[model samples]
Target: MQHDFLKNYKHKTKESRRLYSRAVKVFPGGVSHNIRYFEPYPFFVSGAKGKQLSDVDGNKYTDYWMGHWALILGHSPKVVVNALAEQAKNGILYGTVNGVSVELAETIKKLMPRAEMMRFSSTGSEATMYAIRLARARTGRRIVAKAIGGWHGFNTALMQTVNYPFEEEEGLGLVQDEGQFVESIPFNNLDASLKVLETVKDDLACIIIEPVLGGAGCVPPIDGYLQGLEEFAKKNGSLFILDEIVTGFRLSLHGAASIYGLEPDLFTLGKIAGGGMPIGILCGDKDIMSLADPVARADKESLCAIGGGTFSANPMTMTAGLLTLNFLKENKQQVYSKIDRLGRMARKGLTKLFAESGIPCQVTGEGSMFLTHFSKNVVMDATDIANSNRELLKAYHLALMANHGIFFLPTKMAALSFAHEEGDIKKLLEATKKIIIDSKLFKRFA
Candidate 1:
C-alpha cells in the first residue's frame, strides 16, 4: 500500500491534536511534562498488553519504550494485574508501615547488597533528591559530582546545566537551558571530570553517578571509570552514591553495582521495584539512612529539615512490589537472557540498515534497553549525545511511529521489556529499516 509521510500520516494522529488543544487551556503545553508534548500533539495511549500499545486513534504498536522504561514486565502483565487487584482490595494507603513495605525492603537489600537499609518515596526524583541530601548530611558538604548527561530526575540539582552546547552557551551568556547550581563537566572524559571534582573537593558532599547512563542513551562507562570514581570520592572524603533508578532491577537483580563490580555507599531504585506502581527507594548502610530518623537527627524542633513524607511508603505499592520482587527473583536470570537476545537482534538490525545508507550511527544499550544514536561513532558519554543529530533522531522516532507501529520513547530512548518477543523485535527492526530508507537521513548526514 502506498502511503504519505507528511500528508496522510498527519491525519492519523487527530486525537492528539484535539487533546492537546483542550489540554493547553488548563495546562501550559497541552501536557503536564515538557517531553510529553511533541509536534502538533502527542499520541495518547488507550491501553497496552504484552508488547503492544494501542493509541487513542486505534493504531497498535510494538512498543520498545516500555512506558518510558518503567514496565520491565511490559504493560499489564498478568502477575502485576493480579497482585495490584489483591493489594487494592486490602487497601491503597495505610499511612503507616505494613508487611508488604518491609517485604520490598528486604528483597531490595538481598538483591542489592550495598543497600543495607532502605526508605521510600513515590518517584525517582524524590529518591535521588533525598539521597543527595543524605550524603550531604553524612559528609557535611554541598557540591555534587555527576556525569554530563546524568538524569537522576528532573530535579533542579541534577537536571540543570547538562547537555548544553558550551560554544553556543558562551554567546548567550548562559550555561544552557534554565537551571542553576550545577557544575557541568564533559562525560567519558575522566581528566576533565576529575579536575572539577578536585576543584570542588572541599565543598563536595558526594558523587552520584548512573553506572550505565540511561537517559543519555544506554551508554556504558569506559574501563576503570566507575572504579576511579570510587577512589576519587574516597580520597576527597565524599560519599559515593549510584543512581540505579533505571538500571536497578531492569539490568539485573543486583543492577550496575554487581555488573560493574563497584560498591556505592548509597544507592537508589525506581523503575522496577514499584512493580508497575509509583514508588522510589533510597537504600544504603544503616548509619547513612539513619539520618532521616527523627531520633538520629536530634533537635526535634530542628524544623523536620530531613526528608520524610507522609505517603512515602504507602501500603498498596509495597504489596505490589512484594509480588513483583518475588517473581523477578525467582526468574531473574531467564528474564535477562530473553531480553538480552532481543536487544542484540534489534541493535544489529538497526546498525545494518544504517550501514546500507552509510549513515553514521551507533546503537548503545544493555540487557534489553537500546538507543539508536546518530553520531560519527559509538559514544562513551552524554557529550556525544548532546553533539549528535537530534533532529534526525526526532525524525526517526516520528517515522517509526508512522511507517509501522513500532513505538519507542519519543526522546530517542528504547526501553524494552520482558513481554517483547522475537516477533516484536523483528517488527521494530523492519520499521526502523523503513524509516532509514524513506528519510534518506544518511545523505543528509553525508
Candidate 2:
C-alpha cells in the first residue's frame, strides 16, 4: 500500500520516495535514464560501498547492477572514493588540461594498442557522437552502417537497439531510421551484411559495431564475425569504429577491441572507464585526435566539430578514472580472474537450474557481465532473443529481488563487479533455483 518493494525490499531507503517526488516535477520520468525507471517509482541511493547499494528507504542490496556495469572494482572502492574526495577538496575544475587526464589517457592507450590518442567527454553519448563524426570527417562519406539494435549514446542516429527489430507500432519504417542514413543489419549475417553494404558501400563513411552485443539481450558476436566486419569495412573503403562503451575494461585489459584483436580506425569508451563517475572517451590516431586539439593542426585553428565540453574532463571524474585504472592495472590478474570466476559460477548455476526445471532458459554474457534470457537455446542474434521467455524472466527478476536479496539489471542484461564473491554467486543461484521451483511457467516445461 505504501509503495510496495519498501516493506518488501530489504534495503529500502528514505531518499527513494523523496527523489522520486522531487525528480518527477523537474524531469518527465523522475530519472534521466531508462533503466532506472520502474513501474511505480525508483529507489534513490543514499550511498554505496563495496557491493552494497543503500536506498533512501534503508534497503541494502547486494548490487548486481553495479552502477549499470561501471563499478569494475565495486561500489565505493576506497581507491576511487578517496581519490575523488581528495581531488574535490583541492578544487573541482579549471579551464585547462590536467595531469590525471593525461595519465588516464596513457593507461587506456596501453591497454588498447590500436588507440594512439584520446579525448574525454562526460557521457557515452558524447564519446560515440564524436567517434561517428570523426569517421565521417576522415572518410568524407555520408552514410554510417551500424549493426541493428545497437544503442550508441543518445545520438538520434544511433539510439536504435541492436538485435531487436523495430516494433511496427512505433511507425519507424524499415528502409531507414526516419532521417539519418543509419543502415541496420544483423550482427553475424556476414553475407547479408555484405550484400546490404553493396547497396551504398561507396557512400559509407563507417561501419560501427559492438564487439560483444551488450544490449539487444547480451548477444555476443559469432566467431569470424568481427573479422568479417573488419575486412568488409576496409574492402568497401569505410572506417571501422568499435563501440566498446559497455565492454571496455570489463572485457579485458585490451577491452573488447584487444580481446578480439580488432583494429578499428576509431574507438569510443565509457562505462567502467569513469570508475562510476560520468565519463566518455573517443580515441584513435594522432592525426585524427589532433582535430580536437587545434594547436596540433596544420591550420592551427580549432573547430567546433572537433568535440569539446566545459565539464568534459572534470578533475574529480578524472581522478576517479585515474585511480580506478591504477587499481585495475596493479590488480589486473586478480580482478579480471576473479570477475571471470563469478561469471562462470553464475552461468553454470543458472544453466543447472534451468536444465533441472526443464525450462528453456539461457545465460549469455561475457567478462563481468551476463544476461539471463528465458530460453534454453543458443542465441546468435536478435530474433532468437526476441522470442525468449520474457514473461518467466520478468517474473523471475521480481521473485529474485522480492523473495531473495539478489539485485539484477531490470532489463535482463546484468553486470558483475569485483565486490561479488563466490558466496554472492551462490546466493544468487540458490535464489534463482527457488524462483524456478515456485514458478508455474517453469513447471509448464515439465
Q: Model 1, 29: alpha-carbon shift in Å?
A: 0.7
Models 1 onward score TM values of 0.92, 0.91
> Candidate 1: which pairs clash?
none
Best by TM-score: 1
lDDT of 1 at 351: 79
Q: Which stretches of candidate 2 lie over 4 Å from their true place?
A: 1-22, 161-164, 167-180, 296-304, 439-441
- Summed over model 2, clashes come to 22
